[model samples]
Target chain A: MKLKTLVLSPQSRLDEVCSEACRARINDYFEPVWNETGRDYTQEELSERMAEAEVIISSWGSPSLTDEMLQKAVKLRAIGHAAGTVKNLVPKQIFAQGVKVYSAAPRIALSVGEYCLAALLTSLRYLPEFDSAMREGKWKIAGLKGRELTGSTVGIISASSTARAFIKLLAPFQVDVLIYDPYLSEEAAARLNAKRATLEEVMSCPIISVHAPKLPATERMLTRELLALIPDGAVFINSSRGPVVDAQAFMEELQSGRFFAALDVFDKEPLAVDHPIRTLPNVLLSPHIAGASVQGHLALMEEVVEDIIRGLREEKTMYEVNEKMWEVMA
Target chain B: MKLKTLVLSPQSRLDEVCSEACRARINDYFEPVWNETGRDYTQEELSERMAEAEVIISSWGSPSLTDEMLQKAVKLRAIGHAAGTVKNLVPKQIFAQGVKVYSAAPRIALSVGEYCLAALLTSLRYLPEFDSAMREGKWKIAGLKGRELTGSTVGIISASSTARAFIKLLAPFQVDVLIYDPYLSEEAAARLNAKRATLEEVMSCPIISVHAPKLPATERMLTRELLALIPDGAVFINSSRGPVVDAQAFMEELQSGRFFAALDVFDKEPLAVDHPIRTLPNVLLSPHIAGASVQGHLALMEEVVEDIIRGLREEKTMYEVNEKMWEVMA
Candidate 1:
């Protein structure tokens, strides 16, 4: 008999996340029950669905599997989280109960990596500046000659999954990559085709990207002194969390016009209307969208579904989140 | 003994094109004659330099080697051109005289390829649009989800050096590439890891890039019908010469907002003051800078100098342009 799988995501989100082909695959693998209601499940509804589910498929806006809900889920074997983090969605106690947890963080990491790379290339070539100049009917903008990413040095702040994905994307370009990750060993760095360096050395590169996670230890990791290390004409990109960087120092550095920056995250979302960063010509700002994309969302569902099927078949799954991984995950 | 080489380009240009290390390498290879006048050589000065030089190094603004100048250049065995095209710099008669010609067009092609890839990634991610929206202090602008280059189809119009460079740079992305070059055989397309397709089939791809040369046969190659084949939300890039595309048809297609474009070349550049393309929201315009960068310019000199030295040593040169190649080259 096929395993009983309960999908907590509403039908509208299921339509967006899973293509018809994916839904067909899901039907083939399990006796699936989807939330027909057009919105998130209520606590009573979640408990009712959890009681019969051998596996749970969760995504954004899905109700958390609280202690009371878990008590009712006697048949639960595993959870496939179609989202970046499973921290808020699944309680840690589920692991002691021998429940398997699979996350789609790697899928989101790929999207963030693509965004970081695209931002670097765009900033290095001054695409936005040139587009603005051309819009004003101005050609031959002085001092606007572009720089090639080829044969240059790229610095990455952390050896996070997102950073690894970005490094893989940069393989085609003949660039030297320097990474500063306290957790990464020399052999690991070599495997990634990067040299392990201090934070200062990495920051000094002509192209520096930050991919540090937002842990208590990492908050304000990029201090004023580190931010000041970026040289003139350098391009800085931050697709990671904002609190990991010193916001005031980053703004001051950009205001000085010493370097260019592409910021996808800010200390505050919906950045204030009077914020000075909005008026800075040397920076490219976005609405905290480096990780979310239509393709990414779809891929997340596919990954989780495939992993769920693998777990049911007693096969190795690619994205299983063990208890050890739960502590350091972003 | 070092070979006798006359640099026809001005001192200022030489300084801009060649780095100090490149100059040192050139001095090591050639008993060089520099243009200390800080300007391009006049006809009289050119004739005087040609009388004793065994090799000539030419660049932009350098005087052409006319019949009169060639007659005086009895000792000239080769010409190294530090620019994209040598057609305007060296007369065809020089080839018949057994004088080898080498150009820096391959170097320029690499730069153009880098620019094209950068532009495509920038456009696909809506980097410019997001930046603008954020600059205006707006967040959550509806319908701004990004697309990934991974697992997408890319269409290339030609198999020129620039296009080949671009195809090489796309190795990391798991994208299916299609080519519409009549000159390329199916076997050659396979070697490039791309499928050979007709113009209409190529244009049907969501990511289409035009790299056709400017030739009589290729003029207006992208007709109105072909431009209309592009699907909605597709990205179009044209980094090659502009006259090869039907400008009016392209403009109309872009005006409809069916697709986005990043145009680096124009039929009439320093594009007209009142051209409607200047204000198009779906297009990114650059000032004819797809092939020119500080690193590209410096590499041009280095490549030409290396080829000149190799030729002097009776070795195979990488950038040699023979008579047959000259006929079909852009």
Candidate 2:
């Protein structure tokens, strides 16, 4: 008999993430328990439901699995996270307990790469400025020349999955890529068709993109000195995480109007409602998106479903985030 | 001795189009005659100067080379135009006179391709919509899910030089390309890595870009029925001459908010300041500046300079327009 599976993603995303086709597939193989209430369940509620479910499909609204909660799921053998980064959702003890875990990080990374490319291209052509000027009934402003991506240098702050995907997307331009990832080897960088460089060297390029993780060692990685090294008319893009950049220092540079920036992540999202960066003519701002998309959820959830089915059949599953890799993985 | 060359472009663009380095090279190779006043020269003024010049460097501000003006330049054997499309500046009589002519058409076409790519990437991620929403202090609105360029089908309405370059730029995405061009054969389309399709079939894609010529046979190629056939949420890009699309049909479709359009040209230039298309939320408007850039002029002029030098040596110039080809060439 097929193992019973319980889905614990945010009820708001249940329909979009797991469409009717997905539900029908689950019914064809295993029974599915879908919570009717659009809320995260308490530990007690999850523990009560654990008695019937041997597998769990978790996402944003699922509570972090604790040691106590792990003991309640006596028959549970697998957990599939239907979103990027299982770091906050899965405890270290789960790996020691032999519970398999999988995440949609790879799929989500591609989406982030697409967003970063969009941001980079948009900044190069001054799309925001043109749109704003057109809306204000202004036409053909002087000094509005645009930069082309071809034959320009692009810098990647770190060797994250999104950065890798982004570099792949830029293959046609044949732009020089400088990567600043201390964890990445020179040979690996070369294999990705990029040159390994110091953070300062990377930031000095005409286009610099931040893709480092939000870790203790990476806090304020882009220092004031490094930020200032960015040449005039250069573009700085930040879509990974907030704290990696010295937000105040970056904002001051943008305010100087010597360069441009497209920021999708910030130190404080929803961006203070009236932040000075919001009014900067050279800045393109988006509320902490760049990672999620409606069509993307379909691919993400399908992968999760595949992982869950593989786990139920005791087959080896791809994308399983093991304990040894937890420290570096987001 | 080198040929005597007279630069007849508007004085406003002299320094920009021909930098000190360019002027130094011109002086080294040719007896360069530069206009002192930063203004367009009158036909009589040009006639007076043409008598002494063996070569002419003309741009936007130069009057059309009528047979009467051509007669005045008794020693002229070459004309290098530092801009796109010499059809307006160089009459058929110039070609018939066997005067070597060169244009920056290929370089300008490349810039247009870059702009088209930027527009496509920007629209895919809904950059304009996000910018407008964020400016209004609306953060993270529902139903704001963006589309990614990967795995999507892109439709090209014609196989112009800009279209060819645009297709090359899209090589990294590995998306399916559908092309519609009566002048193109299936073999030629395959060389561009695109499948040939009917115009209606192409318009039904998630992204459709127009690049047909503005000839009598091609006017209003994007009919009202074809405009209505575009898929919902699809992006329509028109960086080529705008008359190819039925203006009223396009405006109506965009006004309905069923899809998005990024238009760099209009049937009417500067688009009547109070036009309804200007205010439509789904439309991204730019003042007809996509075909050229300030930075690009350096390379363009250098090519023109090279052609003039070659022409003086009686070598076959690569960009010389011939009488047999002028009728079909833009």
User: What is the C-alpha local distance difference test score of each model?
Assistant: 0.88, 0.82
Which CAPRI tier for candidate 2?
Answer: medium
Per-residue lDDT, model 2, residue B270, is 80
Q: Which pairs clash in the backbone of model 1?
A: none
Report the number of backbone clashes for model 2.
0
Ten contiguous residues with the weakest lDDT in model 1 chain A? A11-20
**Candidate that would win on TM-score:** 1
Best by lDDT: 1
For candidate 2, give the DockQ.
0.61
Model 1, DockQ value?
0.82
Candidate 1 at B283: error in angstroms? 0.4
Tens digits of per-residue lDDT for model 1, A1-330:
888988888888886677778888888888889788889997788887778989888888888889888888888998999888887888778888888999999888888988988898888888888889988888878867888899899999999989998999998888999999999999999999999999999999999999998889899999999998998999999888888889888888888998998999888877887788999999988888888778888888889889977887899899999988887876
Count of clashes, each model: 0, 0
Best by DockQ: 1
lDDT of 1 by residue, B66-153 (tens): 9878888788888988988887777778888888899999899888988888899888888888888887878867877888888899
